[model samples]
Target: MEKQSRHIFSKVFTNAVLIIFSLSCIFPLIWMFYSSLKEKRVFNADVVGLPSNPTLKNYKRILENPDYHIFDSMFNSLRTTFLSVLLIILCGFIVGYIIARVQFKLNRVIYFVFLLGMLIPIHSLLVPIYIVFKNAGLTDKWYTLIIPYVAFGLPIAIFLVEGFVKGIPVALEEAAAIDGSSFSRTLFSIILPVTKPILTTIAIIQTFACWNEFSFALVLLSETRLQTVPLAMKQFSGQFSSDYPKIMAAMLLTMSPIIIMYFVFSKQIIKGMVAGAVKG
Candidate 1:
């Protein structure tokens, strides 16, 4: 009876803590969304109070105003994130497979090189990258952002992919070899299908990173036409500094897609991380 009571107490305590943490995590987003519907004056007067008179003016202003160009920036961010993640996944898969399966003496060294990349402070290299791009006349170009996004995204993607690849049984490759499959054929036909979960994990991770990235986008992209969502949000502060409602509305708009994505694929994300952890 004592043990049963102790277990019940523990479970109850754990749940209480979890509920508190979850509320803490979600409160900011809730506040931001609620505050977006309020008048700037109302929000300033009662920052935490429920909106007494909700309005859609903030949304309308942000969406309809040509100066905001929120939709265009969203499109640019989406385009860059998707293309960069695709390249990262493809490169990560190929490199990960080679490191996992190939028996070359340099394989370990190559893998360590990628691991080392994760240790390097990305900010430290920003000046040099800017200089190189400036010299090559590639600044402000879409590919300029895409290239660095892929390069920085590779280390984590490769690490995850390699862990997943190692978990796959070697006998499957041997069987494919015996059946007269070429290496590339074996990789595409036999390996890639099994790697979908971890790939999904990589895609989600890289997508978020590329989407939320500000420093690189700010430094590399100078043209207003090429600005991403993060940069567009910065504009609200510059011109409409006191318009808290509009800024909050813009933030909710910017983060909505990612939030929806997480809700939809939350299971897949958890499964992928667990699978990688077990395999690795």
Candidate 2:
């Protein structure tokens, strides 16, 4: 009975802690939503309490405004993110397979070269990258944004996919090879099917990274027409102050897709992470 009481007490303590943590994390989202809906007067007067009269004006204004081009910015963000992730996944799959399965003398060196990227601060290379992009006549172009995103994102993607590839048994690939399947054929047909979960996880992570990337995009892209959501949203902030409600509304719009994606593939992502952890 004493032990039972102890376990019950522990459970209660854990529950209380978790409830507090959950509320703390979610409070921001609640506040953002409330601020977005509240009248400007109420928001300025008292931010903690509920709004006296909630209005959908901010959202409506956003949708109705043609000049702001929020949708265009969103489209640009989506386009760049998709293209970057696709290249990363394809290249990552090939390189990841080689490192995970094939044993070559230089394999470790090659893996370390990829791993080296993560250690270097991206800010450190900004100047060199800008010079190279300028000489290549690629700055201010869509490819400029996509290239840097893929380059920076490759290391993590390779690491994730390589870990997933290790979890796959060698016998399957060997059997396919013995039957006269080419290396490329075996990898695409046999290996890729089994690595789908990890691939999804890698793709999703790359998507989020590319979507939210600011520093590189800010420096690389100059045209107002080419601005992404993160960059375009800066317009809402003035030199001295910011429009809190409109900004929050825009943030909610920008963040909604990623949140939805997480909800949809969260199970696969968790499974992939667990599998990769064990394999790596």
Candidate 3:
């Protein structure tokens, strides 16, 4: 009876902690949603508090603009994120597999260099990158976004995949090879199948990062028609002031897709994380 009581107490304690943590993450989102229903011109000290009355005017205003190109920017961000993540996953898997499976002299050096890329702030490289892109005629296009996103995403993707790859047994590859399965077949059929969880993690992380990135997007992309959601949201900001409610509405719109994705893949992401961490 005492042991059962202790187990219940422990479970309750853990639940309490998780509830607090979840609330912390969720509160800002709740606030943002509340603000979105407010009038754009109204600024109140109690803005974050519950709204006494709600209006969908802000949402309607944005949606009513036929030539605003909000959906186009959304598609632009989505297309770039999709292509970048696909390339990151493919190349990251290949690189991670080779590094984790094969022995080579330069392996450690190469891995360290990848890590170093993460250490350098993106802002630090913006000027040089802008100049290079300008010279290469890559600025103000989807490729401009795709190229940088892939580069930024690769290091972390490689790291996540490497960790998961370390957990996969070497004997499985050997056994598949002995049965006349080619390396590519063994990789796609055997290797990638086992790494779905980790892949999901990488995909989610890269998608969010690329979607929210604003600094480089602001500097590199000048064509209004080609702007992303992050850049488009800046339309609400003027030289002297900003619209809080409309900004909130825009933010809610921007985050809605990712929030839905999280709920959809929360289980797989959790499972993959646990498996990767425990096995690796």
My TM-score estimates for the predictions, one after another, are 0.93, 0.91, 0.91
Clashes of each: 0, 0, 0
Q: Give candidate 2's error at residue 220 in angstroms.
A: 1.2
Candidate 1: give the clashing pairs.
Answer: none
- Residues 102-126, model 2: lDDT tens digits: 8989999999999999899989988
- Tell me the tens digit of each residue's lDDT in model 3 across 1-280: 9999999999999999999999999899888988888875453556766666789988888778865567878888888888988999999999988888888999988988888878898889999999999999999887788898899889988887887898888999999999999988998999998988788778878888889889889989999889998998888788987878878887788777778877887888789777666665
174 Cα displacement, candidate 1 (Å): 0.5
Report model 1's TM-score to 2 decimal places. Answer: 0.93
**Which residue runs does candidate 1 get wrong by more than 4 Å?**
239-241
Error of 3 at 265 (Å): 2.5
Greater lDDT among 1 and 3 belongs to 1
- For 152-207, candidate 1 gives per-residue lDDT tens digits of 99999899888889889999999999999999999998899899888887887899
How accurate locally is residue 213 in candidate 2, as Cα lDDT from 0 to 100?
A: 83
Clashing pairs in 3: none
**Candidate 3, 192: how far from true, in Å?**
0.9
lDDT for each of the candidates? 0.90, 0.85, 0.85
lDDT of 3 at 280: 57
